[model samples]
Target: MSPSGNQDSAPEGVRLQKVLAAAGVASRRVCEQLIVEGRIRVNGAVVTELGTRIDPESDLVDVDGVAVQLDGTKRYIILNKPRGIVSTMKDEQGRPDLRRYTREWPERLFNVGRLDADTSGLLVLTNDGDLAHVLSHPSFGVTKVYIAKVEGRVSAQTIARLTAGVTLEDGPIAADKARLLSASGEGAGSLVELTLHSGRNRIVRRMMAEVGHPVVELVRRQFGPLHLGTLPVGKARELTKLERGALLTLSRRDAGDDRSAGDELSAGPRSQ
Candidate 1:
């Protein structure tokens, strides 16, 4: 949608640079330079006019190629979930759930997908329903990276088996990538990382167990384009500008698949 809703022949909206700065794209002065250099796009059109105005409420903006969220009212959160916290907003069994983390935000934010009670790591919380669905649904090719501490030492053969695919009780599933991180000895515990796009219930644990090594503990380190960097456990924070851009880009890319089926985004290689 091009800039619109002129009031008495005037642009009647916020200045482009100001809107860009407000979106955390850059400082106001730098945003002006970006406008001059034509590094910005509004509604899929390159916008370089210094006097250009836009409706932040309706205009779709992007920096370089990444989509920028113009709505400040929406919340996109990254939570480093700790073990033993159920993924739901409320738990019927009275177990610890995600309600506490969401209580502080005024907007009703729900987790994009889930990390079971015993497993924890990065969980995205957002009020953007469209983007949430794109990130959560496995059909869109959104991948998740999990690091598992298993009961027995993992070997190259086991890693190959994971990538080669395994037959679970539900059906056949394969890891997008698998690697053995560490193994102390022949009988000691092992650290293995597996990347997968499947959303089957407790899939990581079930896959490891199917290979004769049950998961002792598991943590998701990556989800699609986002990663669980050094964020402390059980804490929630707003996504950084770059992080937010990458996530939104992934969502938009997947959303495009409907118009151009068979042109899905690559889930990357078979290694973590």
Candidate 2:
């Protein structure tokens, strides 16, 4: 039965959690939780043990009995998300989600981070889990540039308060950069650009609100080396090769190097 057979016969095996993650069923952490819950089955038998391996090509691996497929290609996309669309892939209330904005995108990519349903601008989507994880982590110190319209005139004192740091319900929060775009009138608001290294929930709004100038409108204009310059609202484009490389370099620098805490201090945004 074995006569000079050279064709490959080895079954390609991968960790059960990785298989579930690659299938977009859930994140690795959530997949581990699912495994602990005995919801994953391999070859018709429920398997709950962590680090369990399965052959993707031969074994009938399923999550809750639904068969899943492995993801072979890594996808990355830059989406110019418009207002009102939720950044998440799915909404439990059956509300319109980011998937609608990405219907034309070829691959099924998840957002790298998130912009609030009300917030809008450049959002990065990708199937590369590692990059997504790295980009979202605070250790990467990916600076996000946001242009905000505030309810009142942004004075030097307000900018000083932001740069000095303000205490929030969660903890003390500070802006890495803050500057007034222009002061309109006595009651009219001013446009300001604020940058921050941390991605706390609704941080810009909360910070400005704390300073007596609540954000009336907010738009994220940049992340790291990526900028939203001249890109019309609701229209997205792919990242340039150089931009991708620069982001990767920043990620590496942030991950492996340890600099003084003061080194992370960002300058206040200049008036433009």
Candidate 3:
């Protein structure tokens, strides 16, 4: 009578195959193959037993020669980017990139959007692919706010033109909101704040230059539900639980509004 108990149930701890799968290493079936091939090791010992259970918290897991942790600690980070550093992971001309700042991070992370090397401000980096996909998609319409210091004084007509639309080499683009922050002075540039949702390359600089007020400096202050705050330049930190929850909610909401039956968010880098 099998002791009159739940005979077909899983035992304590999670299956080794499941742990590997949950870590985004491979599928369950593939993980099983990895286990059978003696590629998986737990606590420095090769594990080949089928249905083997182990505690993820205490046990050290490694796949092949690389250590892997499936603890579901998805990293959501906000970096206060500084000028003269690229936003990408690698650079061809031996220039500084985001990798320089995130060398200590264990998990593989990607930047959500781009900030030009010449610009500075808030930037989001994460390993959560689904949330990144949703946030980066053009359809989500995530808002971005920037403060710009231009070479010369800006005019009401220029603001109106920017509010209306500006013709560029690519096409036409306009700011959702554009307002002056400070007046012009003797050889001092004017300060302006602009808000928009476009991800076009160098859009802000291009628009300002088109109106004869080339951007001397630019800083992104906000993006979607995240803010730059008082974080120092060239520093990175993990997102708080409340911020992560709110961002996840925003991403899910944007995804839910899709009309297509089988549409999936594209996981690609968005420009700012």
Q: What TM-score, over all chains together, does every model reach?
A: 0.88, 0.66, 0.68
Clashing pairs in 1: none
Better of 2 and 3 by lDDT: 3
Which structure is stronger by TM-score: 1 or 3? 1
- Worst-scoring 10-residue span by lDDT in model 1: 263-272
Off by over 4 Å in 2: 1-72, 257-272
Q: Write the per-residue lDDT of candidate 2 for residues 88-180, one digit (tens) a residue.
A: 999998876877766776777888889988898889887766667778887777899999988877888888888899999999988998888
Ranking by lDDT: 1, 3, 2
On a 0 to 100 scale, what is the lDDT of residue 120 in model 2? 88
**Cα error, candidate 1, residue 37 (Å):** 0.9
Give me the displacement of residue 12 in model 2, in angstroms. Answer: 20
Off by over 4 Å in 1: 2-8, 257-272
**CA error at residue 97 for candidate 1, angstroms:** 1.0
* Residue pair clashes in candidate 3: none
lDDT of 3: 0.78
